[model samples]
Structure formats: structure tokens, C-alpha cells
Target: MSSILSGTPIVYFECRQCKCVLQNPTPDVLDEWKKEHQGHTVTETRKYPLFDLGYNDLKKAGELAQIANELGAVIADIRFMPHTRNPEFSLKHLQEVLGDKYIHVGELGNANYKGTGGIQLANTEAGMRILHGLLANSAVIIICACWKRSECHRVYVAKEYEKRYNVDSTPITRTSARDLLSSVEEKNNPQLALW
Candidate 1:
């Protein structure tokens, strides 16, 4: 039998006899552990939805908040430089709009965002740790500036997250945003649904 371990980093697995402790082990590592400890059971303790969205798609901070609220997720700003010409997207204003539900994980940001070198993580481990902490509580919606997921660095971030956490990221499309917004509107004004 495996003994439970607790700490700030959150232990994912522990073997008392072998003194093998895995902290935040990736899916592959967990699989290997299962094979090594044939009789031991490994169960996924928690699963939180992960999503990627572009602020351009939502256009307004309020809409972003609304979408996050609908999904019961925290907004993770993954922009290396979380500033924009658009006042609403600027870090301070976005934080103001999102309040406690917003967090800027700059470490996950692409340092070469402006260069042709492609996405480069600023601090992969640190960023992942922060995201892991958040995942323990609620779903996470990673946001970036680019409108297209294919052309955005957030895609790379989402990929990295999937690799580290073994979770698939759902790309929030424009249609989905519109539908969520429409739902919010209808909920706010029940009469709107009749039209």
C-alpha cells in the first residue's frame, strides 16, 4: 500500500517501502509507477477543465469575465507583456475587471513573442506550478492576444500544459463566445429569449 504525503507542492504519489515519492508526476511517470507497483492503485484525484481563448475573440474584459463565470474558471493571462493599446486588455484594467478570478502567469508566456523564433517559455516549471495550484481549485482559461489559436503562443502554452498535466485544452471559439454571451444576456433579461 502507498502512503499519503502532503505538502505545498502537493505529492502525487508515494511509496513508503521504496521511498519513492513523485511530486506532480506527469502522466507518463504515473504510468511507469503503476507498472512498477503492479498491485498499487493510482487514481486521478481531481480533474479541472482547461481552456484557451483570445481576448480579441471576446473583445471586452466584461465578456471574458462573463465567460469565465459561466464556466466557473479562473482567467490566466499568459501574455509575456500583458499590456495593450486597448485599455480594456491592459493588465491593470483587466485585473480590475476580473478581480480575484484573474491571474497573470508571465512565466508561461512566450519570451520571443515579438520575434520570429516562435514560442519560448519564460520559466516552464514555475509557470506550470502556478497553474497546477490554480487547477487544484477551479478550471482555468488561458488567454492571449491573438485571435487565431493556430497563430497564437497560447497554443504552445496549452500544449505544454497538456504535456505536464495530462489534460486536454479546449479552444474557445468565436461561436462559443457568442453563444455564451447570448446565454448571459438571456439569463439577465428572460424576455430576450422570446425574441
Candidate 2:
């Protein structure tokens, strides 16, 4: 094992096709790290993962569900396109697949069906109130119609959430599963998965 591992960045595991990173660091290690840090524990914790199924193949959904389960994620939003008028289809697809294993959200953020923007957060006071309610309710929102994370408006929205709501509305961009979990750990208020 040393011969193969020597002078290497200890890739505990990896996929043959996708370069998505993976690791098996134990829960005890996370607990110890938490003990060392003086960070505040997240009470109203949520994953708030933003995803785009358009670029992703259907085969990845199960893997996504399993990963969320492993990470103690409570929600897996399957938000739909608002402009198309058939928003329920999004929920139907996820329901046929992931089912009730995680919480589902529709009409995430302010996404227009044209496959752009975060859910168009309400601009008015009533809209802000609604946005706040959505944030308080959701864990992971995967209804974006685009590929690149930069194109998605949720990133900026999450930043604002960090400033205003004091909740982690940010999206976790990890090359692998381990990196994702670590990102969660390093947050101002890390989410403790309820799985």
C-alpha cells in the first residue's frame, strides 16, 4: 500500500469517469475538530445545496440522494421552473426517485423557467418576507436551470443570507464528498446532519 500511496495526496477513493473527490474521514474526527473550535453550533441547520439537474444525468440522482443521506442532510430540493407553468413536473420526477427520504422544495429562490437566475427573491417587503420564509424552511434547493454555479443567483443570495439572516444559505462546491463535508465543517455555523 505504501508503494502506491508514497508521495501522493492520499486519494482515499475516486471515480473512474468524474474527478469528483471522495474520502472516508470518520465522525469522531469531526467531533474532535468541533471541540477544538470555539464556533457556535448551528441550531436551525440546513444544507441549502443548490443544484442543476439539466446538466446532470438522471443516473446521478440516486448517488445524490445517498450522498445527502450520508452527510446527514435533511432536504433535497427539486425546485421547478416557474415560467413554464408545469412546475409540478419537477417535484414529480424527484418524488418518483428520492421520495420522502428528504424534504422537497418547489419554486426555489427566484428561478425563471428560461433556465436562469436564482429564484427571483421577492423584491417587495412581502417578497422579502417570503424569501425569509423559504430560507427558514428549505435545506437543499436543486431547481436551477443552468450549469455553471456562477450563473446561478443563489450564490449571491447566500452571501446576503450570511450577512442578513445569519444562516448558511451558501452552496457547497466540493471536488469530492469529503471536501463538501469539510466545507460544511468550516462554515461560521456548520450544519449537523440529522440523518
Candidate 3:
């Protein structure tokens, strides 16, 4: 049918809150969030450390992260496709779980997961608040879309944080989750994805 042929690519949006992608988020809602807040700053994008992992499959998480960490990854994107199952886990929860163990990895940019989230965050005061909290805790977000680009970009958070607070940020890269779990004695297990 002509309708099917004319459809735009459906980019999934992972809720920074739930960790699950907001599938096909409506543009009206996206626009509303952007309009609610004004005078927000956007930043240049830097390449994030990425790995190829299928996000839809929760089953292989252990296997993927375990092996990847064993190999030399500090963070793992074990999933590429954001599914409903990923749940809406906020960046705050992640900070609690990872604590200091969560080494900075991934790109330094904004959340581009939904492909609309970045635009949304620019508008929503609530979104900005959450981002500020994550930055306060020194959260290093990692979102992999296709292994080459970040589905969820948040480098802006890092750089903006630096500029606002007059702090210097050291971003890290990650090939897999294995790098995070490995110790100094582990062979081939790279540490501090950054220099």
C-alpha cells in the first residue's frame, strides 16, 4: 500500500527514567516538552565508546555483559534495539547501582535514544532537573543504537556540566561490559576507556 511505503522510520525512544525506549513517541508531546522550557543549550557531539548488543533480548544480558567484561569493557550496551521490556529505570537508579564502580564510558552528548528525547529534554524543566541530578552524581550514560552511533546522546550533559560548574570532565569509552568488571590483573581487559 502507498501508506506503508510512505511511512517514516520508527525510531525507538528509551525513557531515561525507565531505561526502555518510548516507542513512536508523538510529536505533539515532544513539541510540548520543548516549548515548556526555553533558553536551553545544545552542544557539540563527541563519539561515545560503543559496542554491538541487542537491547531487546533481556535473556542474553548476563552472557553478553559477562563475556564483554571478561574481555575488557567497563560498560556494556548489551542491547541495541530498545524494547518494552527494558523498563523505565531512571539515571538515578543506575547511579545507585553502579556507584563509583560505574566508570565513565560512552559518548559525551544528549539523550537521542527516542531520537526525540534530546529535543524533549531541551524543553522540559523536569527533564533538565533529572539531568542535573545525574550530572551531580557524575553519571556517564551509555546508549548504543547501531554500534556506530549513539541512539541516546548525552555528551551535552557532560560538557554543559563542566561549563556551568567550572569543572573538568574525563569521559571514558567502552567496548563491552566486561571492561567494567575486570580487575587490574586481567589480561587484555582494558581499563578506563579514557586516557
The lDDT per prediction is 0.82, 0.41, 0.35
lDDT (Cα, tens digit) per residue for candidate 3, span 1-195: 111111122334333433333345479865664454334432222222222332232233443344333333333221223233344322333344434433323223223445643522333344434444443332323333332233433344444545654545443333223233343224344553333
Model 3 residue runs over 4 Å out of place are: 1-124, 135-146, 149-152, 175-178, 184-195
Score every model by TM-score.
0.77, 0.43, 0.31
Candidate 1 ranges with C-alpha deviation above 4 Å: 1-44
| Distance from true location, Cα of 11 in model 1, Å | 19
Worst 10 residues of 1 by lDDT: 1-10
Best by lDDT: 1
Task: Please identify which of the two predictions, 1 or 3, would achieve the higher lDDT against the true structure.
Answer: 1
Name the lDDT of candidate 1: 0.82
Ranking by lDDT: 1, 2, 3
For model 2, the local distance difference test gives 0.41
RMSD vs true structure, all candidates: 9.4, 14.5, 19.3
